[model samples]
Target: MTATTSDSTNAYSTPADDGASTASTASPAPVSPWPRRLACTLVVLVWPLIWVGGLVTTYDAGMSVPDWPGTYGYNLFLYPLSTWLLGPFDLFIEHGHRLLGAIVGFVAIGFLIAAWRGDQRRWVTVLAAGVLLAVIGQGVLGGMRVTMSARVLAMVHGCTGPLFFALCVVAACVTGRRWQRDRVLAAANHTQQGQITANPSTGLPADALRSPWMLWPTLLFGVAYLQILLGAQLRHALPTSSPSMFAHTAMTHVATGIFLWLLTWVAWSVMRGCGDLTLSRPAAALVCLVAVQLLLGMGTWIVNYGYPSILESLPGSASYRLASKNLLDAWIVTGHVATGSLILAVSTLLAVRLRRRRWVLTQLPH
Candidate 1:
């Protein structure tokens, strides 16, 4: 009897010890900050790259170098700085854009290395690899645009820049310490919803598992990308495009802009109501940015083609003349282009973060 009681106690104690060991072993390792920092740096570099690329387009300086992978028959990096600096405006912008692109590529490589080395998450590593691949592809596209002198290629290149930037932002988000902590907490919180009668976080109905609000960020992202495509089409319209076709495209673009503005406002309101700062902050920015973009769209038109005859009755409108290729015209046009990229980046971040949050929520009792 004594031996049997001792054996039973040992059996119970052994399983408890093993369970504790398992829990400790399963705990996630600490995330490294370096990967996140490097990714953020890559994201920053891409914005100026987009801006300079826009300037190249705004000034018609795409073919200034007339060579791919080289400048004036000299190696790209070996080209004389003095000539590049003191050269004509087109050469300066074109060469500078190329150099900036190369820098972004190098930073992407560093990010990939850091992620693979420090980030234990397979997805994070894959995200870093995707960023590098995108940077390479973007470089190739830009090169092809120059070698083939295809305007279509130019448009594609322009479109991909923001997409690549968006990926970098994602990489940064996933590699963040807060993201890792949230993932671990969500995993720990994992329990069958059937086991719990109600959510402790909120007293909302269990049916709120698939909330309609969860889809808004994703919808906003889609609309924003569509707007980008339409804008690119208008910006790179072929010489053969008829005035009627251009007018049609412009009207479509304007209609889409108004719809996007409304959608952004709705998204902001929903996110704010949810009280999720991560989603709401970007949503708010998207609202402000879309508003600014609409204004910039107007400024871009006024700078490029001047105000309408109807607006001529206004004091400034009557005096506003379309300055062909002036400083102000270039800045306004480039600002519009750059702002579009910014809006897309912000929307991408919000969409991804919200998606992750929703996934976590789905795993919980709610």
Candidate 2:
């Protein structure tokens, strides 16, 4: 008999070699979707939380209750629905904020437990735990803001909300099915270290394989957040400051706004050319959001500080008096606040995605 062997058979001559290939190509462990789903739900609820928080400030009702962890004489949870719904608008908003915050807190606890129990990632579990802790701290800060009537503490509390909300959004994103899928692919391909080798499976262009270019996002997030702080200071400051002092703050804010707008355009230009749809899409959204914010910024001036006094001398301008905190004022200003938070959250999410994708690409073997 003639000794004949197939080419495939000759190639894999040993079982050990085949087994090694299988082991090397194995996917990462599957992530539970439920934990991420719960996190997403928390993200949804937090939006209205920020909106209501803005309304509380819009109406200047942060001190309506004169108490913390409780509503008037009753425990927080037991506060009568009738009283909350029928009370003065400020009290209603203030009390409703507390109630909504409680709900968010409970949901966050559930999210933490789910992530800790269901997630295989130790870091994810740690992050979930941190979110829970942060929520609790937020409530305490809110309470202290009311009880101590501290404006500085109130601003701190206000700023904390956006950061926490961004965290929730990021948690949801990482726990998501797509994220898990990418993670598994990265692991199987040895792309986890963020350095893309010249491998055929990477599918990335030479430019895509470069660093994530994180500096622009960092600058955008920082500038956007600082703008928010300036806004809060302008809106919530005591009315007793000298005109020169107020003018200085106002001028600084305007200058910063101009600089921020320029930076955003530059960031948008870079993102628009990135060739990656993921980066480009969010970058487009960022551009649109900033444009809307500019118009709203103008509206904020029209509503709070009235038509520019310098412009009153112009034709067809003298008929307008500056509107105070009316319905339109509340909506415009509150939307401005909420939109700022949204921008920050978007920036954070984009930054995380870029970092993760780059890290995934890096893990592939050459």
Candidate 3:
């Protein structure tokens, strides 16, 4: 009987030992990277819509239909197939923007679902939901702008695009393993016995957070966003011919562009000095985008000037105007807008990376 009791105890203990061994050997389930990649991909995909929307705005096509949620008495989708198929191009651009808006709405919904299901991080899921809500609200605001024909609403609607872009940026950061790794590294570094002191001149924390690497990029992003807002207001003022419109706004846009150019230079300097490849790569990208934006701005001005309205020409006059009024100009305008959105995205990413480094510096066990 004692032998039997010993055997049973040994059997129970063996299972217990096996359970412990299995627990140790079984690694935590690998976190899928798909959600993060999807979030980033979605952000990029939405840029075309941003560009298209900007074109629609610049052309003052907001009220082409003079109706909300419909394009001339039919639901947006059910609008007469004949009209949709053979509509004025203006109708097409305006309706196309609406359709892209709907697509973004659905994409945002999918992102929310993926984040909620696949991400271990709760904030990521919450942020995805928030973005979905923002897209929905923005859609409504768009409809309202069409209904009211209010310039103020239009401005608000335009401004919301960048904010939405920023939110997606945050979502991307939260979902990425690199961001988490940086956070962990920073924490570990900061908690070390000897905390690094910030450089007195630059006010950067000695550890990872205050790296001049982070500060300059964050500043560049802020300036870019302000520039975009200024540009939007200038475009908005064009149709109204408001005396309150300052030619200086255009000049301000130019100045901001210059500032952005210089900021890129500064970022490059910082990157070179710091020798951080991560920071340098993104800074280089920012510089390239800025260069492209400058060219686009100049091209837009040239196009506006060189192509006087052919319709304004006397009959039989040579119509030297290229296809300047069609989808191509719209696309150029959209690209300009999208570049601004990209700037905002990259800037926010740098800021988060810096923040994680800082968090580690501050919280890691010293």
Candidate 4:
């Protein structure tokens, strides 16, 4: 008999909205684990070793020891301290490399411990442990080179340093704070876009299959890695009696570097067109680095050709001239190595960010 009006507000409310709100509020805050920070610190700390190793390699100091596992039959740490203080320049360079290598070994141990005990991501911790073991193997390879005094072994030992640096870069990426923050933010964004849906076939979300911004970074990373490999080969190549080897390798290196810059530029353009400011910033940074590299390359050439006077000085009296030469060489080598490391860092960040973004977009409830 009496008309009853249904509650309009309750009738119109959806369960999805309530669920999203509750999930958002109930999600745990991200923990700042010690392993993550330790991993990052290890990466930062390893750069010095990379630089020192480069110096040793460029100066042909790999044979400074002429012995493996120990220096002149004494433990690496206990080897005559006075030799380093009074020995030839090669001894200084070689022993310095050993010291840096030992330091890296210790840091690696700490990194492994932190990864095992402090990291939340089990796979990442496992990977870090693997990297630590790889570094130890690398040390053994260095010792073998000393014992054998084989040029080929020396080349392999030299090549492994960059590979080890790259491993550390990976470790840094896995435990990075920026990566974790991006993952959280991306997940949140996906939820807001309603793009999150689990696929019935693969059990992965449809959004995971999308994201046009990632191809650019991946392409650039490939180019950079290939360029480094080529450069390493060139470094180990025998010196030719004819200048053609220098000309050819130098030209090829320069050309490849130019191609790398162009590829990076294209990647940046793609990022910009896609409205991906996150990637665009690193792209711009890479562009600047390449530009610096070009200048340094040209500077080395000019100093090499235009300054014959410096080369004429006597060995002992030419300290100033030698200093200038060393300075230029150091710049060129350091710039090359640093740029390579930066490329690795930026590419890794982009890869991780894009992955997180994909994950977030896929989780949205469209």
The per-model lDDT (C-alpha) reads 0.77, 0.73, 0.68, 0.61
* Arranged by lDDT, best first: 1, 2, 3, 4
Evaluate model 4: give its lDDT. 0.61
TM-score of 1: 0.86
- Candidate with maximal TM-score: 1
Listing every candidate in turn, what is its Cα RMSD in Å to the true structure after a full C-alpha superposition?
A: 8.0, 8.6, 10.5, 10.7
- Tens-place lDDT digits, model 3, residues 1-366: 011122112221121232232222333344666677778876876777777788777677788878878777888778776776588766777898898888888788888888778765565677888989999988998999989888888888887888788778877776765554333343333222444444344554445434444577678878988988987776666475655555678778988998898898888766544334455577788888888888777656545544334434656435546454565665566677778888887777766655654554444345
| lDDT of each residue in 1-366, candidate 1, tens digit only | 011112112221111222232232233344467888898899889999999999999999999988989998999999999999998999999999999999998988899898888765556678888999999999999999999999999999988888887888888776664353233233323333333233344443333335765687778778888888888988999999999999898888899999999999888866665545566789999999999999999988787778866677888777766656788789889999999999989988988777655554554443
Residues 95-120, model 4: lDDT tens digits: 87787788777878887777666654
- How high is each candidate's TM-score? 0.86, 0.83, 0.76, 0.74
The alpha-carbon lDDT assigned to residue 139 of candidate 4 equals 83
Per-residue lDDT, model 2, residue 102, is 91
Better candidate by TM-score, 3 or 4:
3
Output the better candidate (1/2) by TM-score.
1
Query: Can you tell me which runs of candidate 2 are displaced by over 4 Å?
Result: 1-30, 181-206, 212-214, 238-242, 313-316
